[model samples]
Target: MYENMDKEYVLNTYPRNYVNFKQGKNATLFDDKGKDYIDFTSGIGVSSVGHGNARLADALSDQVHNLIHTSNLFLIEPQAKLAKKIAELSGFDVGTFFANSGAEANEGAIKLARMYGEKKFKNKRYKVITLEHSFHGRTITTVKATGQDSFHKSDFSPYPDGFSYNKDINDIYNSIDDETVAVMIELVQGEGGVEPFEKEEVQKLAAFLKSKEILLIVDEVQTGVFRSGEFLATNLYGIEPDIITLAKGLGGGVPIGAVLTIHKDIFEVGDHGSTFGGNFLSTRAGCEVLDILEGYKNSGELDESFIYFESKLQEIAKAYPALFEKVVGLGLMRGLRCFENVDLSTLINRAFDQGVLILKAGRNTLRLLPPLTISKEEIDEGFKRLDNAFKVLS
Candidate 1:
């Protein structure tokens, strides 16, 4: 019924799987026909605390009854608390601007960067440099910011100006000029095939940009909130970005995005605002996610889980050397790099039909973004299903 209704009513934007999931718990999902599947994608890394977490459900329900949204015109307590918690966790005196999604969060970051550039360079600087193959967002501006042309090829004509891609430090140096305001990058280019930048190179780039007074914007939309085994990937790389954008797993499956900045005074009043950003319910969910992660961190469970998951990925790579060339990414955000000739889409579809849900990163990368709260048994089951899929594919 849902598939029929969706076909009739919804726009065909995504090439969706055949299954219509009706329920989920932890790392498991149930389709409408009651078939159970091990979930490795974590709703594209949004359900960090896992599906149907009772604590999050209760918090969201309570918030819904009390308040769902109170505009940015008024100060909301939950929003304030969540912001404070994020600041504390960030280890910096920072301010946050909430948005509805990663794209919006990144859009906010870009605007803030442009505004700061205007003030610092007397309106002479507005250009923002991003890395090659980086995926920022879907908005017109962000599509231009995205380094890949394939993403912006559909009706994205006359690309926005002031955004350029660089493949190396020399390219970046050549791109920089008096009008350069910021350099944006994803430490791990998640959608670009789970590729990570070299730590030393990133450090040198950040230092060089700082020397030129250019702001560093780190898009942590996929790598933040313990998804990378660290609270933030920037912390993992020891790079302190002037601005950071976060979303995916921060709200524990709830839709929320945030722009966090070390330089809080970059934007003043009347500079930015969002109608539904940091509303009561979303902030409540965000706070609950933080609370759950904090508890896990205090109990050392998160670290143990991270280690176990990484080791299992390494084991898989070693075991399936004929199929998988390598494993990339940090913590739970991992990718199994398939052999060059492998059809990753077919493999992912086969895995789905075999009662496992995974994702594709680039052309030959099978991405796994299991929930942080997923258990060892769930991980084992997920991998077992994946192996079964591989056997059928072979």
Candidate 2:
């Protein structure tokens, strides 16, 4: 019914998995037919606190009863509180602008950088330098910001100006010019097969940008919010970016995006706004996610969980060298680089049939973005299913 209904009504944007999930509990999902699957995708990293989290549910429910949205024209308590919490956790004296998705957050960040360049340089610098294989967002401007050509190949032509891509530091240096306003990058290129940037290179780039009075924008939509063993990937790498865009796992299972900046005075009245951003329900959910993460941190459980998942991934890579080339990424955000002959889509489908839901990152990398709240038992079970899938594929 869903397959036919989706074909009739929904636009064919995604080649979705065959199963239609009916319910979820923690890292487990139950399809409409009552078939259970270990969910490693976490709805592409949105359900960080895991599915059916009572705390998030209660917070969202209470906000729904009280007030869901009051527009940006009016002051909202949850929005303010959530912003403050994010600022504190970000470990920077920052200001935040809320949006509805990662793309919107990045769009806001781009606008902020342009405004900052205009206000400070008075030279109308607008060009932003991004890395090759980076994925920022899907908006016209963001599609241009995204360095991959595949994302912009179709009818979205006459691509937006002021965006350039670089493969390395030399490419970045060459791309920078008098009109360059900022350099935006994803610390871990999640969609680009969970590729991680070298630490020294990132630090050097940040320093170079600072020396030139250029802003550094880190797209942490997929790497932030405790997905990388730290609250922010910047924290993990010790890179102090001027602006950071966050979404994906920010509101646990709810949709919320944010642009955080250390440059507190980047925006003025009427400079930027989002009508549905930071609504009561979304902010409440964001606050609850932060609370859960804080608890994990304080109890030393976050580190433990990260170690457990990392070790398990390493074991899998070592145990199955013929299938997995290597395992890359930090914390629960990992990727299994498959052998050249391996068909990732086929493996994913096989895994799905074997009661395990996973995702592909690039062409040959099996991306694993399990909930930070995933347990040891769930990890063991998920790996067992994956092993079974591998055997079947073999």
Output the lDDT of residue 307, model 1: 87
Tell me the lDDT of model 1 at 177. 86
Candidate 2 Cα outliers beyond 4 Å, as residue runs: none
For model 1, residues 108-184, the per-residue Cα lDDT tens digits are: 99999999888888657889999887999999999999998788785768877999899754578788888899999
| Model 2 TM | 0.98
**What TM-score does prediction 1 earn?**
0.97
lDDT of each: 0.89, 0.90
Number of the top-ranking candidate, with TM-score as the measure: 2
TM-score to native of every candidate shown: 0.97, 0.98
Q: Which candidate should be chosen as best, given lDDT against the real structure? A: 2
